[model samples]
Target chain A: MSGFEAATAVKRIGDGRYEADLDGDFGFAEALNGGYLMAVLDRAAVDASPHEHPISTAATFLRPAKPGRAELVVDTRKAGRTAATSLVGLVQDGRPVVEALITTGTLGAAAEPVFAGPAPAVPVPPLEECTSMLPDEGAEGFAGQVDMRFDRSTMGWLDGTPSGRPEIRAWFRLRDGYGPDAVSLALTVDALPPVALNLGSKGWAPTVELTWHMRAVPAPGWLAVHGTGRLLSDGWFDEEVEVWDSTGRLVAQSRQIARVGIGVRK
Target chain B: MSGFEAATAVKRIGDGRYEADLDGDFGFAEALNGGYLMAVLDRAAVDASPHEHPISTAATFLRPAKPGRAELVVDTRKAGRTAATSLVGLVQDGRPVVEALITTGTLGAAAEPVFAGPAPAVPVPPLEECTSMLPDEGAEGFAGQVDMRFDRSTMGWLDGTPSGRPEIRAWFRLRDGYGPDAVSLALTVDALPPVALNLGSKGWAPTVELTWHMRAVPAPGWLAVHGTGRLLSDGWFDEEVEVWDSTGRLVAQSRQIARVGIGVRK
Candidate 1:
């Protein structure tokens, strides 16, 4: 199985609970990424509901997760015609690693827009000119599974230049040929690096809390990720992301508050 | 008591369950405003936790709540050293009106930032020059409780001129003598009219779902609200808000997706 499919796959072990096979493929260093954990949790939520898509998710990181066998437990609170509510938890050794409240619903792919402005004005470079951020060697981590080609315009921090704006835009998709689904859109909304990077912060930015809403089912092709941060304060920052399908529709939108990196010398 | 403090005050009847007093003072027409409901919900969530603030809240509106008696139910999932997780539900007549997952934690008011970008650049006019949105006659309802002075830049839609950009900035605070607090911050984060109004949409814009995080405690003074809508499409629009305190600190941030008015013509 491809890594994205494997990491998000859950087998129903019965009684509103499922067994999730979490591997090292979705981790950064030894800890699993928050988005990946939410994706795993969402699978169970979707399974528990009559709805087809996980519409909204709010996840709080309680403990760092390691690659292992975990339990996906879901509690159905209410099920209505338009939406369903469930509390989903990812547990290891009977301790909660990530807990989320997810609401599932069905969104049509062919819904016409009454009114929609064009995508943000930043243009991406042609495929040949886009800079690939995939790692050079190993296929064991997050960067290895997804192809991220940045626009290079907002990536000036590499050359000691702070773009004076907290924004990053890129073209993204799975390296294993998986198209966008509601579950994968959860990971894609948080797939890019922190927008604080372009504003001169450095090192690993850890997300404290993340909440996202799925607007529509994505069309087949590349997804454009636009991330921006409104505030970067003492040890904290707020980042917002918009995911647009290649067909020019918004698939998902997310906002998160995270810890600023260790040292920001710029 | 002032409208805000009285509406949000919960009587702790027992363990994990409290009684909420809903009143029409926080309403528009017969339905209670979403922000006002969230403000009351945050109050109960903060009181149940050992921490002092409601750091993150993701609320889903399941049913419309009217002015009456309701129950505030709190379910603690994890109580960590720095943070605690609880599922809060507001029920009236044994049906869920709103349910939320709130993470409560401590944030310092006097903490110094290593770095912070400036507040959003759309400056509001001085208090003397600001335009009042309060209804001239009825001194009763949500508009009467909070003082909002608009920048008037995005209000050109009132005169048949669309700014072609979705943005709104205003100065706000409770008309009552209370200063900034966690409960009040929740209301302030969602206090303004929908930002989609500037894009030529009109009438009552209802929030489908909203998620917000408290970054820091606010100092005593008028709060500046900077609002923006990224995309308006498919009869839905997404709004993001940043609330800055008088001391120039980024206190709270929120994002919500709402449907357009009853009808749209362009």
Candidate 2:
């Protein structure tokens, strides 16, 4: 199995139950990446669903998930010819950690969109002009597994020069040679550094809830991710990300509301 | 009780359980407006949570809800000091119709956003210069409950000259004078007409999944609701709406993926 496929692997424990191990490599600090958790839950939902692609998913993060053994329970709500809906919950030690309503459908690879809007408003420069996020010593933890090249203009947060706006643009791919697919797009949506980073907020900005949609079946190559936020108030912020494939087709889109970390450095 | 309050009333029956009647006045033809269903569901989540505001909600419409009776079952996932999360489901005749993960919190009326982005990009015209959706014979169905005025430019679809762009902008408010609140904002987000109408697609577009956030408490008066879509492909389209309060604050935001009605008009 490929690294991503293996990392998100699920074993059927019963008719509606699944077993999985939260990969430690996907963690940031002590908390697992929310996107990784969604990918894990997507595997369980797809295994139990008659549909092939996970088209839409609404996930609520109940608590921080740690790297360890987990159980996925898929409760099929509706199974139809065009689509299927399932409630997939990731549980650890009998407690629900993350719950998601996943809707699956099949997409034709050759079909074109009847109408497509301009790509995400934020423009990203060519890959050669972008800065690589990999450090000279190499990346570790979550960054190590996902190769990313960021638009330098939005990376002012690293040098303490926030853009006074909430936005991030990056090109993403898996280091394990896993090509972008419907399941992996779930991970790609939440893969960018929190938009709050550009708003001068510090520390870990944890995602509370996230909803993503797969617009089309992706073609293999580097995926461009553009994220922007509309509001940051009362310690909360909302981020919207759009993923475009190499063929210039919009592949996926997502929006998430997250808590702004209290730990800030002036 | 006010019209909105009565229309969305829910009675607590047991621990984490409630019952409500789906109001027919909120229906579009025979189908209930997805926003009204959300308002009904939000009432149950608020009643069950210690918090007063439904901060974030991710809902999946399993089936079209009819006017009559329905049951709401709330399963508390976490009740933290800052917020509470619950899995609320609307069931009719022992079958689940709508399921949502609602997160509740308390927002201080005086709290200002730490940093707010520019409001939704789509600009709406002044209400006085706009075209009212109320027919000459007076409003009926969902239109009777929620008053809306559309920007003259976006009303081209009505005259068979579609703008050929997926966009809609309007001013919205409740007819019964309940004013704006977190609960009512639920109804405001999905209140706009489908964006696909401007794309020249015809008939009733059914929303499959919608996720909305309560950004801040409103300041009353009419609300500017701006809706836009990024793509429509393979019979599926996504609409995003932003609700700006009379005081010019963004009170709520939402995005929904819906099926494009197969029946089209030349």
lDDT of 2 by residue, B1-266 (tens): 85889989999999989999888998887789889999999999999989999999999998989899999999999999999999999999999999999999988888788887876565787788998866663767787788888998987898889898888899888989986998889999988888889889998888889999999999979999989999888888899999999989988999999988885433
**What would the TM-scores of all predictions be?**
0.90, 0.98
lDDT of 1 by residue, A1-266 (tens): 76788878999998888998787878788778888888888888998999998878888777788887999889887787767878788889998888777888787778776556567677566656778764474654787888888988878877779686888888988888886998999889888878888877887787878998888789998988999877665577888888988888878889988877677654
The lDDT, on a scale of 0 to 1, for candidate 1 is 0.81
Error of 2 at A76 (Å): 0.5
Clashing pairs in 2: none
| Per-residue accuracy of model 2 over A1-266 as CA lDDT, tens digit each | 85788889999989999999888889887789999999999888988988888889999999889888999999999998888999999999889999999999888888778889987666788999898876653777888889889999999998989887788999999988797998899899999989899888988888889999999999999999999998888888899999999999999999999988885433
Relative to the true interface, what fraction of contacts does candidate 2 keep?
0.75
lDDT of 1 by residue, B1-266 (tens): 75679878898989989998898777788878788889888888888999988888888777778998999999887797767888799999998888887888888878776556676766666777778765583666777788888888866776778676788888998888676888888888788877777777878777767898888888999988988877665566778888988887888889887767755545
